[model samples]
Target: MTPAHHQARTDGPPHAPELRAAARRLGRRRFLTVTGAAAALAFSVNLPAAGTASAAELDAARLTDDPFTLGVASGDPQPGSVLLWTRLAPVPYQADSGLPAKRIDVSWELALDERFRRVVRRGRATAHPEFHHTVHVEVDHLAPGHVYHYRFRAGRYVSPTGRTRTAPAPHSRASELTFGVVSCQRYDQGHYTAYRHLAQEDVDVVLHLGDYLYEYAVNSSAGSRAYPEGTLPDLFDRETVTLEDYRLRYALYKSDPDLRAAHAAHPFVVTWDDHETENNYAGQTPENSVPPEEFLIRRAAAYRAYWENMPLRRPQLPDGADLRLYRRLHWGRLAQFDVLDTRQYRSNQAYGDGWQFPGPESEDPGRTMTGDAQERWLINGWHRSDALWNVVPQQVTFSQRFNSTSTPSKVSMDSWDGYPASRERMLAGAQAAGVENLMVLTGDVHVHYGFDIKRDFDDPGSRTLGTEIVTTSVTSGRDGSAKPANWETLMAANPHLRFYSGLRGYTTVSLGRELARADFKTVSHVTTEGAPLTTAASFVTEVGEQGLKPA
Candidate 1:
């Protein structure tokens, strides 16, 4: 199968000057406050009024099927709070999610024990049809670095119990932190066997770097999994372009039992790549023939659906066509995770966004991967971080990836290799901030990669500034091989690259005070079900010393 990144064949012009100006203007505090409040108000209108005399409510006793088919999830954990999520979709994939056009009361509970003998927090949230009947409850006043069991209930229906954990106290010294990194799970391409295995791992949280659900059409037979005829609805037989289209697409993907199992197993911290909206889009610029104005509409729909479906707080909600997703999460004093959004605030790809030789245009200093505001934010975060490890969880490769051994090496325009100036600024910022243990976690390419982030890729003996671990896709490229076609060439051209593997799986990283160990896990196949998972490779980097060493 062709790599998903190769699918972006540029056939449209760059973003208009006015749109760029608008994006820049969005940085102003006044504009953001106005637009954000307006958007929130528009969304709030659908919610039932507090202390209303007579408001419509869904009768849980009248339901026949399970409303929690998509399962329960929790995310964005804090020392005192965690966001709980569940959508009441008895019959998922429907336009209204098999619910009437009204508000439904969903009660949720958090307990110290799995059996609910020690109930801690309980409250009710209104699931509005305007928001696809999804409930996002932000539970606060919880203990730090503690495990909790949570579930939701609507009428007589009860959701599956989900496990969640809060971050350690701000200044506490955490001994260790372990998380699973995963991305690029295309429902049509293969089965979600990776998620099934991930649910069993002893991970505290799961970081979804991007491409949670592809926008491609899924056949009625459901592509590689080959479900029985009529299993999937006809609504999913086309690309997602509208609000309803995106909503149904998510319903279809989340309906999978394995995917739901993973959500119920651990909390997820998510960020989107280009596929969440379109392939290789830059800022407001699209990849194909769609007009910029029309494309923004589609983008708005995609962003809204993404926020509604994920276990995110209200602050991350979208405002028209824009959503602020880049934020920081702290795991006590052990590590600080700066999750980034690369696709939203990036310059158009150099050389039409394809694999090409470097040039002045590609090396332009003005072109940015993370827009100016985000760049400053990241650098500032690093400067103020007091954790033992400063971890950057992002969507694309941070190190240079040479495709061939030729003099003029061809690199992916979609990655950091395309914007050398941007990469330079990032490295320089980290150095200036005196970051000791900088670890970048990436997921986009269908293959796993371990790179020693060098101060200068042109010089093999240059100082190893940091380490980057790229996880393989969940199931994007179908069943992959141990060595892809470019594996040897990449290894030969870039000595900084230490490990490479082509397989379907995720990566687990255990961060301690002195050492951070990364285990590259893989599965033999994904086109068919029941693929056994195994460890493909393991590498570790010391706290003060950078660079990967085989473990």
Candidate 2:
């Protein structure tokens, strides 16, 4: 479930013809804007090509301010390759990211040590103004299961050193794997204290489930952070709509020190839920008020900005409003992660899209949560998985969450509970594929939840199929309590729900051959900086077992 602001809208289904027509209009508009001479210069050098910038060609001396202010990041690691990212944002809030209307040469180095004395790979990539002067370098031909240090240099200025690691060899018998999970960090709700603590954890990688940044406006005071007046630009006070707006929003969010520290410390595998575009959006359908064609234009802008800002590879780049984000990652023989994109190909929420009672429309087998193609992809991936643990890093809760202990309990329409047929298909697929150790990692409700994914929700003694670990927000709800007001009722109503906590923090999981352990880490407060971190709870599920137990 999301915040109250994402109210349910009872809009009819979206018309495909109108959406296609609107996309053509938007494409023509973009073509006209990019036909100028400056646009030509920006695109000419923006090809995804690798080359070295000569010493004389480096513009470091001309950059008075550090162009690496947004910091460096890595993501989508493979056994022999990894993606490194950095934006030349001397003035991040500006439309051009404080760069001229041309391309700039950015050099990066991958070293065996942090001191750069033993450099392994070094290359140059051209950052074009068309892409907000951001660089995405895919460095390959590295050792498997090895740690590496990376940094970017544009002319004379160098970025902060970032730590990254490659996955273990595909057939290697890796003993254990540990990773952090986080989501829903609304910049205006609270401080990013959880991220500060996460930066210090000894995790291999971080899976950001969604809502990396909200689409809402930020005031001059910078929300709960209480910054001094005029700290944020006036442009951020409006909801993100255009490509420039989305890019600037990313700049402002990435400008935070704690968020930057987390990125520099570990690689992040990210996916979006809804706030990346609009709240409760279903497929190409808008929330309610906007027309389908108009919404498609906004969706295209948002998708392009998302690709430009994240540390994703070339294949993940958006073609209009579509991005192939659902993929699989392997960590030796220990775990296989199936990262999912639920927001992009979901059916419109039944009965408007908020909390609602179960009905025929919501239970239709044709209605999909991951669309037909992705659903088949997931099931097929599971059938071919040889790893011990089949872990799913997805956006929403996969278990049924009952809001009240009544005859007709209400469940979130935006979560899996609203699409029971989809959930059933996923569980059946896993069972058919003989997935013994199933684990689902989720984040979206802004509360920590541990549930036993039962084969049948209505039967308390039904067979447990897997375990779902729902991490709380990084800083969504300003300052949450140890137990929310509905704790007791929800606990009593849902017997499969093993644990629940209303705290602002994340969850760290350690996957091993014998068992998988999860630690719910929470911060004392998020309205102020330097909040003390604590472990709210711990649970574990053993290999070949499907339910969670106290660890």
Candidate 1 CA-lDDT value: 0.87
In candidate 2, stretches whose alpha carbon ends up further than 4 angstroms from where it belongs are 1-60
**Per-model TM-score on C-alpha atoms:** 0.92, 0.91
List the pairs of residues colliding in candidate 2: 60-155, 60-156
> Ten consecutive residues with minimal summed lDDT in candidate 2?
1-10
Residue by residue across 1-551, what tens digits does model 1's lDDT show?
A: 01111122213222335444554667645544543343333333333333541236776777788899999899988998988999999989789888887677788999999899999999988786767888888888889989999999888889999999999999799999899999999998899999999999999999999999999999889889898999887889999988789999899889999999999999999999988888889887789876455576677778989999999887786766788999999998889999999988999999998899999999999999999999999999999999999999899999999889999889999999999999999999999999979999899898999999998989999999899999999999999998998888999999999999999999999999889999999999999999898999999999899899999
Off by over 4 Å in 1: 1-55
Against the reference, the lDDT scores of all candidates come to: 0.87, 0.86
Candidate 2's displacement at residue 280, Å, is 1.0
Cα TM-score of candidate 1: 0.92
> Per-residue lDDT of 521-550 in model 2, one digit per residue for the tens?
999889988889999999999988779999
